[model samples]
Target: MWIDKLKDVSFDGRMMHNMSLASLSYLNIGGVAKVVCYPLHVEDLSNILNFCFCFNVPVLVLGNASNTLLSDAGWSGVVISLKHFLTKITVENDSIEILGDIRLEKLLAIASKNNIAGFEFLTAIPGVVMASINGNAGAEKCSISDLLMEYKYMDIQGCSHSVSKKDILCSYRKGPLQTFGIIYSACLKGEMSQKDLIQKSVKEKWEYRRNRQPISERSLGCVFKNATDYCAGQLIEHAGLKKKSVGDVAVSDIHANFFVNNGRGKSIDFLNLIEEVRYCVQNKFGVFLELEIKKVGD
Candidate 1:
C-alpha cells in the first residue's frame, strides 16, 4: 500500500526496494534501506516528498554517503537520493552553480579545467555538495560557507526557496538552512586564478590530505571534530588509542581520529571503537571529542 502511493507519481529516475546501505556508503557497512529512490530532477524530488508527506511516510535524503553511517538494523523509510536528479554544474558570470547531487570531486575537476579559484581547499574533502552543505564540511581552515553566495532548498512541504549568504547562519560546520529541507542547488562566487596556480594549489592540498589521512582505507574520513586548538587525531594519538580495536574496526594507524573498516567491519564494532577512543581521550586530556560524521537509520 505504501508503494502504491508512489506508483501514481511520474518519476525521471530509478526506484528500487530493499537496497543495501553497505553498497551506498563509503565504508561499505550498514543494512538495507526499505525503499530507495533516485530522482532525476528538482520536480521529481518535490513529487517524491509530496507523495511521502501525503502518505505520512518518512523521507531520508542521501547523497555520496561519504560522511554518514547507517544503522545495521536499516532504515524503515523512503530514502531519496539526489545523485541522479541534481548533478549538473553550470557557470554564470564569475559564480558557479552546483546542483545538490554534484560530487565535490567533479566540481573540483570542472573548476580546475576552467581555471577557477577559491575551491582548492574543497579538494581535500570527499562528498557531494548536498551532504557537505548539510554538515558545512570544510578543510584547510576553509569551509563550504566560504564560497557560498546563494542556495536553493525544498522544504518538507515540497516548496523550494532560494537563500542568500547573509541569511545563512554559519558556525564551524553548520549551515543556516541545514535542517530545513533538501538542498537543490547552490551558487558560489569564484575568483580568477591562473591555471597553473590552481593546479599547484590543488596538487599541494590534495597531497597533504592524502599524506595526513588514511585516504586509501575504507573509512568515513575524520571520525570526530576538533574540541579545541588540538586536532582530534592528535588528541587520540596522544591518548595512545591507535592500537585500540573492536573486531575488524580499528583506529586508523595513519590518522588516529579515523576509524577504518578492515573488511566486513560491523556498525557495532565501530560504535565500540568510538566509545573506547572517546573514553580514553576524555580521561587522558580532559577533553570531549565531538562526532563529525552523521549516523542515520533506526
Candidate 2:
C-alpha cells in the first residue's frame, strides 16, 4: 500500500517491510513491522509525513524502543525511526539544543562533559532523546521534561511547530506531546556546575542504579508506573510475584517491576505476565497498576 509511495522519499538509512522487532526493543520480543523506514534527515521525514497525510495512512514514530512492546502480530503501517537524523549539539550560555535522535546516555555524557548538572540523573536511562521526551521519562529525582525549554516537531500534516515547556503539561512519566507527529530537536535549560562535582554526582547515581537494577539484562525498565504514595516495584514484590515466570518472560528477581526476557521469550508471554501481575496486585490490594511501558500493534 504505502510501501510503493515510501520509495519516493530519499532515505539515507535502511527501509524495509516485515522487519523483525525483536532486534529493536530492549525486551527482545515482538514479531515484525509492515514497513520500517529510517529517514536520514528532517526533510526526508517531512516528505514521508506529507505522503502519509495525503493517503490517510497511519504512522508510528519509534525511538530506540526501550519502553515499547510490539505485538507478535506486527505493526501494519509505516514505522518511522528517527535514529538516522541525529545531529549537532549547540551549547549556549545556559541552554543546550540537541537533536531528537540522540540517545539519552549520549546526551547525558555530553552534558557531563560540558559541566551541565541537571541531566546527570538521566545517564542510566536506556532510550533515545525523543522517547524520553515523549514519555516525560524519569526516575525519582528528575525527568527529561523538567529540563526541556522548547522542542521543534513536524505535525501530522507535515507542518513544523515549536512547543515551549510551558505549553506542555508534564508530570509523572506523561507529557503533552500528542501521538501524531515527529520530534526534530529540543532545547534544554540546565544549571552549570563544576566539572568534578558533576562527574562525582553522575558516578554516584550510576553506582546506585547499577546496584539496584538489573539494567544490563534484557528487560523493559519498569512495567508499571508508581501510584500515589506507593512504588510499583514494592507492590509487585509484595504481591509475591518476584521471580514469577510466564514462558520465557519473568519478573526480574532483582527488581519485581522489571519484566525480563530470557532466551526465546515471546511478546505474548510478556503480556500475559503483565496481566497476571496486575491481577495479583489488584486482588491483594485495592489499587490497579498503570503501565509505564507503551504497547502497540497487534
How many pairs of residues collide in model 2?
Answer: 0
Q: Write the per-residue lDDT of candidate 2 for residues 1-298, one digit (tens) a residue.
A: 6667777766666788789877677777878888887877777777778888888887887887888897888777878888777588898866889875788888888887888888887867899887788888988657888898999889888788888877877878876576676778889888989889988988998899888898888887999988668999999999899999999999999989999888888889999999999999999987899999999876
lDDT values for all models: 0.84, 0.84
Q: Which runs in model 1 stand beyond 4 Å of their true positions? A: none
TM-score, every prediction: 0.95, 0.95
TM-score of 1: 0.95
Screening candidate 1 with a backbone cut-off below 3 angstroms (N, C-alpha, C), the clashing residue pairs are 40-85
The TM-score obtained by model 2 is 0.95
What is the lDDT, from 0 to 100, of the residue 152 in candidate 2? 88
Write down the lDDT that model 1 would get. 0.84
Residue pairs in steric clash, candidate 2? Answer: none
